[model samples]
Target: MHKKETNLSHSKLANNMMNYINKNIDTDINIDAIAVEYGLSKFHFHRIFKEQIGKNIYETIKSIRLQKASNLLITNKYSTITEIASMCGYSSQTSFIRAFKNRFEQTPTLWRNGGYKEYSNNILHNSISSDVSHTSFSHLEAKIIKTKRKKLYYIRHQGYNKELSKVWQKMMAWVYTNNIENYEQIAIYHDNPIITLQEDCHYIACVKVDDKTKLTNTNLPYFEIEEHLCAAFEVEGIYGDILKFIQWVYHYWLPSSGFETTTFPSFSVFEKNHFLNDDGIFKVIYYVPVRYV
Candidate 1:
C-alpha cells in the first residue's frame, strides 16, 4: 500500500477501536478480544494503538469509563453508589470507588455533591458574556441542509465549567504546544444542559482532522460526527448565548418552520474571532438535526 492508504487505514482502525470502547463502556473489555475483532494480533494492535492514540488501549478505556461515570453521577440518574458502580461495570462498589478516586482524587460521593467544582467551574451555568437581545436573525442567513461526516479530535470536559474562556485557553495552548494550527476548532456539547442537571452536562473542546493528521500524539479523545439533515441558522452572539440561540431555534424557529428535531444532537460551527474574542461576541452557524414533518 502507498503511504497515504497506510495512514488512512491506521486512522480507521484507531477510530474503530475508540467506538468499540465507548459502546462497551459498561462491560468488562478484553484486549485480546478487541484485537481479534479488529483482525490484528494482540501484540501488534497494542503497539499501534498506543502509538496512534497516545495511551494504552486499556488506559484509554478506563479514562472513558470514568468520564462516563462522572456524567452519570452529576446527572443523578442512578440513586445509589452500588448502582452506579455496577452500571460502570465494576464488580464491587469498593473497587469502583478506589479506581474513581485514583483517577479523580475524590470519592464518588464527594465528586457528586458539588465537589466537582475543584476541578471544574460552573462557567456554563446561567452566564452570558454578551447580550443578544438587540441581535437580529433576519440579517443572518439560515436554511435546512445535510452535513457530511467529520472526524473530531477533542479534550473531554466534565461538570458545569465548560466556560469557553478556560476551555479555549487550554485548547489553544495545546495547539501551540503541539504546533497543529492547521486544524479546525469546534466545540461539541455531549448533553443538553437545559434538561440535564447542571453538573451532568458534558462538553469537548475540539478540532477537526483527517487521516493525515496524527491523533494519539495530540493526547485528546477523538470521535466521528455522523452526517445529518439539519435546520441550520447563522447567528452572532456571546459564546455563552449559544444555548439561548439554540432555545430560540428549537422553541420558536423550528416549530414555525414546519420541521421537527431528529434524534441527533445539535452543534455549532464558529467563525474567526467569534469564540473567545476580545468583544465577547461570536459569529456562529448552528445546526439542529431535523426532519421535515
Candidate 2:
C-alpha cells in the first residue's frame, strides 16, 4: 500500500478501537483481545495506535473512562458514587475513587456535589466569555422524541472552535466527490465543553448517508448513530449561543425534567452550519439522549 493508504488504514483502526472501547466502557476491556479482534499482533496494534493517536492505548482508555465518569457525575445526580463507579467499569468503588481522584484531583462525591464548577471555571475562563450565559436558551422548550438510527461518514475533530470550518470543508469535499446528495449534516459533541477544556473537546463532523450511497474511493470511517430516546430542542444562535444552549440543557433543564441522560453523547442536526457561513449563525435541532430517572 502507498504511504497515504497505510496512514488511512491506521486511522480507521484507531477509530474502530475508540468506538469499541466507548460502547463497552462498562465492561472489562482486554487489550490483547482487542488486538486479536483486529487481527494484529498486540505490539503492532499498540504501535499503530500510538503513532496515529499520539497517545498509548492504555492512556487513551483511561482518559475516555474518566471523562465518561465526569459526565455521569454531573448529569446523573440520583446515582450514588458506588453505582457511578460500577457504571464506568471500575472493579470496586475504592479503586474507582483512587483513579478518579488521581485524574480529577477530587473525590467522586465532591465532583458530584458542585466541585466540578471550580474545575470547569478554571478551564473555561479564557475560552468562554462570562457574558455568555445559559439564560439565552432558558425559555426554549424541549420535546421528548425517539430518533431512528443513522449511518454517518464522519471526520473526527479535536477542538470546538472556529477552526472546525476546515473539518466541515473537508466533509463537504468528500460528499461532493462521492456524489452523495440528500444528506443531512450532523455534529456529535463527545464532550461537555463546560467541563472539558475547549481545546480538548471531541467533535465529529458528519454527513448522514443512506443505503444507496456509494464511496468509490474514500478512507473516512462510518459510525452508526444508535436509535435514542432524547429531549430535543430547536436552537438558533451564533458562535457562543450553541455552547450556552448545551449548558442550559445539561445544567438547567435536565435535573428538573424527571429524566437522566444516557451514556450516549448528545448530537445536533444542522439546518445551517455556523462554521461554514459568513454570518456565523446556526440553526440546529439539538438532541440529548435520555431516559426516565
Candidate 3:
C-alpha cells in the first residue's frame, strides 16, 4: 500500500478501537479480542495503535475510564461511590478508589465534595476564579426533552479554542464537495474543560448524515448518538461562554434540577457556529443527556 493509504488505514483502526472502548467501558475489554476483531496479531496491533494514537491501547482505555469517573463524581452526586465505581467498570470499590486516587490524587468522596476544584484550577493555571460564577445561566431555563438517534460523519479535533475554526472550515469543504445539503452541524464535547486541560480536551466536529447522503467516497469516521433524555438549552454566546455554560449545567442546574447526568457526552446542535463566524458568536441548542436521580 502507498504511505498515505497506510497512514489512513492506521488512523481508521485507532478511531474504531477508541469508539469500541468507550461504548463498552463498563465491561471487560480483552486486548486479545480487540486484536482478533481487527484481524491483526496482538503485537502488531499494539505497535500500530501506539504509533498512530501516541498512546498504548491500555493507556488510552485507562485514561478514558478515569476521565469518565471524574465527570461522574462531579455530575452524578446522588450516586454512591460504589455505584460510580461499578459504572466505570471497576469490579471492587477498593480497586476503584485506588485507581481514582492515582489519576486524580483524591478519593472519590473528596472529589465529589469539591476536591475537583483544586485539580481543575491547577490544570487551568487557576483561571477558575471565584468571580467566574454560575449566575450566567440563571436567566436561561432548560427544557426537558427526548432526542432522536443521529448518525454523524465527523473529524476529531483535540483542544478547544478559536483554532477550531480551521476544523469547521475543512468539514464544510467536505460537506459542499459531497453535495450534502440537508444536515445539522454538531459538536461533541468529550471532556469536561473544567477538569481536563484546555489544550487536551477532545472535541469532535460532526455533520449529521441521513440515508440520502452519499458517503461512499469519504474516509471520515462515523459514530451514532443514541436517543437520550436530555435537558436542552438554547444558547447564544461568544467564544468562551459555552464552556462556562457547561460548567453551570453540571455544577449548578443539574444538582438543583433533581437529575443526574448519564455517561454520554453532552453535544450542541449549531444554528450558527461560533467557530465559523468572524464575530465569534454562536447560536446553539445544547443538549445534556440526563436521567432522574
TM-score of each: 0.53, 0.95, 0.93
lDDT of 1: 0.65
Q: Counting only residues 3 or more apart in sequence or on different chains, how many pairs clash (N, Cα, C under 3 Å) in candidate 3?
A: 0
lDDT of model 3, residue 16: 79
Worst 10 residues of 3 by lDDT: 126-135
- Report how far residue 176 has shifted in candidate 2, in Å: 0.8
Q: Model 2: residues >4 Å from true position, as ranges?
A: 128-135
Candidate 1 similarity to native, TM-score: 0.53
Tell me the tens digit of each residue's lDDT in model 2 across 1-293: 99988989999998888778777888888999879988999999999988877789888778777887887888887888788777778889999999999999999889888888788777656676423644467778989999998988899888788789999999999888888878999999988887777777889899997778767756789878688999999989788777767777887688778888866889999999988999988899999999886
Better of 1 and 3 by lDDT: 3
Candidate 1 minimal-lDDT segment of 10 residues: 123-132
Judging by TM-score, tell me the better candidate of 1 and 2: 2
Write down the lDDT that model 3 would get: 0.84
Candidate 3 per-residue lDDT, tens place, 2-30, comes to 99899889988887787788788887789
Candidates sorted by lDDT, descending order? 2, 3, 1
lDDT of candidate 3 at residue 131, scale 0 to 100: 26
What residue pairs clash in candidate 3, if any at all?
none
Better of 1 and 3 by TM-score: 3
Candidate 1: tens digits of C-alpha lDDT, residues 178-283: 6675777776664555333444555656777656755335555567877889777777765546665554554446545655553345677778534467786677
